[model samples]
Target: MTSYFNDVAVWQPHDLAYFKRLKAYGSRGVVVKSSQGGYGGTPYINSVGKLQVINAKRAGLKVALYHYGTFNSLRYGQADPASEAKLMANTAKAWGLGKDTLMVLDAEDSSLRTKASADAALFFNELKRQGFHSFDIYGPGSWFWAGRLKIGTSYKLGGWPASYGSSSSGVSGAKAWQYTDNWKGLGVDGSLDYGGQYTTKSAEPEQKPEPKLTKQNVDDYYYTYNPKRVIVKRTIYQHKNNQLGSQANRGRKLKPGTAIDIASVHFSSDKVPVPYFKLANGTYITANRWFVNNAYYELSNLKTIKVIKPTYLYRDLHRTKVVKRSGFKSNKWPKGTLFDVKKVIHWQGGFVLKLTNGFYCTAYKKYVKKIK
Candidate 1:
């Protein structure tokens, strides 16, 4: 399917009306990036803009948040090694995004080569570690031709390709190919110029069958844990616009001792929209930050916590395994059945739960519940 991003920052008053129309018509998903500023300049959107876009997504629009990556010179300052990592991490958390959301790293600038590829790899690895699965590295085709960066494995390519063959060649298994830096269509402002178009086919047509829900399916879905109550010593840092390292401040180091409860533990599945926990002190936290100690905990003993708020879950459309219930009908499962944990597989769509009884499933916001 064709995906359209309104590029809201580019819209004027009249253009805004057209933007809404486009959303109602052709747009399947939107990537809300910073807009061009005054006098025909690019606009810079903040967290508020992101929140607004997410709200729009809740209203049936598939929305994603975008950043120009570390390469944007004028917007994020020069490539500062010290600020880049922290900026990426803080941005991931601030966006409230996990693996499901698109993290576009606009790398169209020529300045990125100044930094060593090793440094870029380090930055990309950290972004992966911070729970971002999808990455869009936008740049010209020469960057791919000359630099010889592992395009398909490292990230999805965006930007204008030198030729149609180059666009179809597939960089780092590009999910979408942006054809031109400038694409003008009917009713758009001033010949809209940016990325081209998606080279890959839409993922919608190849969806897999939903797995049957069973006790085995539920129990196998995630790992369980009982964490010891201890203070996780972490250093929080402030990120500069385009830097990779954290700046040194007098109290930059968090206190060596701060008591926080480990609370309940569950498996960290790429397939599930992890629950956000509000600490006793009102501090909200993401499930992605919860680290699993495989050596100590058994998947069965840990308590499974049910998600309290509404969230989205991504089920892999490719995995198809039929489950056989003891007395239930061939296609249906009884509620409250507990299954054994089998294996967790990470696929392009999301994580998949493979059960001992032969079922593959994904978790959605309201559909999951922990067995007491």
Candidate 2:
């Protein structure tokens, strides 16, 4: 008598009906493909992974997720493993998957035969950093048989090697064994959850929220002179070097309004020294004042603004649709006018200071000077 579970990829039907059917067929749990490398788009991430995760949980089946590793990709190289691991953890959190949900790495590329263990350690370590507790590595049983894949005691890493054999799992020390591609005529991969590894649960500590900044504490922010974090002011690409050119945009472009943690700063050796912020994730972005905002005054203590230039009020945060003059006496506020700030609305890398009069004005420092 063997207790088993089903593993599914995008190839399987993702409807709630299908998962209900699997539950009816005596499956207690399911491993759903969730995401892949940095791209994590379309088929790389199971197109219906979010739906499948929701449905699987609704159908009363314990759910797990797996990321298809692409560390061997030529463009991304070794960085892909950590990036993909972060993608997996973030994607799972976005889908409301509990941290206890088993996160497995599907490593099947032949190129990994030489460095499988190293890549696995890198992937699992990143996952742990993101607060994921339970982990497993899945690949062909032959890789495990040949000692290409190995788990260490540094973390609670488990193996889920697959080999379609009748009686044995082919490899030893597996936490779970995928013993069949088609289990019980269902035409889906099935595995035996040895030692209840797939059913056990753990709790993750809740993360604390960032502190709110105000005018009183503004001086504390600048006392250090060096910023520990920065907000992107424009769409910018990451680079491996601090050189100034489009050719050096080697990594992905971060969207405006994204906050990045800084690891350290490096000045380029070019004719005009350019400062670059090294991200905590080992990527680099320009510390240029035109591209990113590092000072706390840019956001904190924005109580009110004195209109120094011709300013128009907007009905929305984007300021695309101007506020009509019919409601107010005029559509434009003259220079030297003061607007009482109700609250500041942080838009994409910019601020829209919502006035107490029920209209929004741009918080660009050049256009308006802070009065309060």
Leading candidate by TM-score: 2
Residue pairs clashing in model 2 are none
Stretches > 4 Å off in candidate 2: 39-43, 73-77, 200-372
Alpha-carbon shift of residue 11 in model 1 (angstroms): 5.9
lDDT of each: 0.41, 0.73
| Per-residue lDDT of 93 in model 2 | 94
Per-residue lDDT of candidate 1, residues 207-267 (tens digit): 3344443444543322322222333233222122212122432222323233344444433
Model 1 lDDT at residue 243: 25
lDDT for each residue of candidate 2 in 219-314, tens digit (9 for 90 to 100): 432222235567676677788665536675578777666777777866656454345678777777776655667533345566777988877998
**Which model scores highest in lDDT?**
2
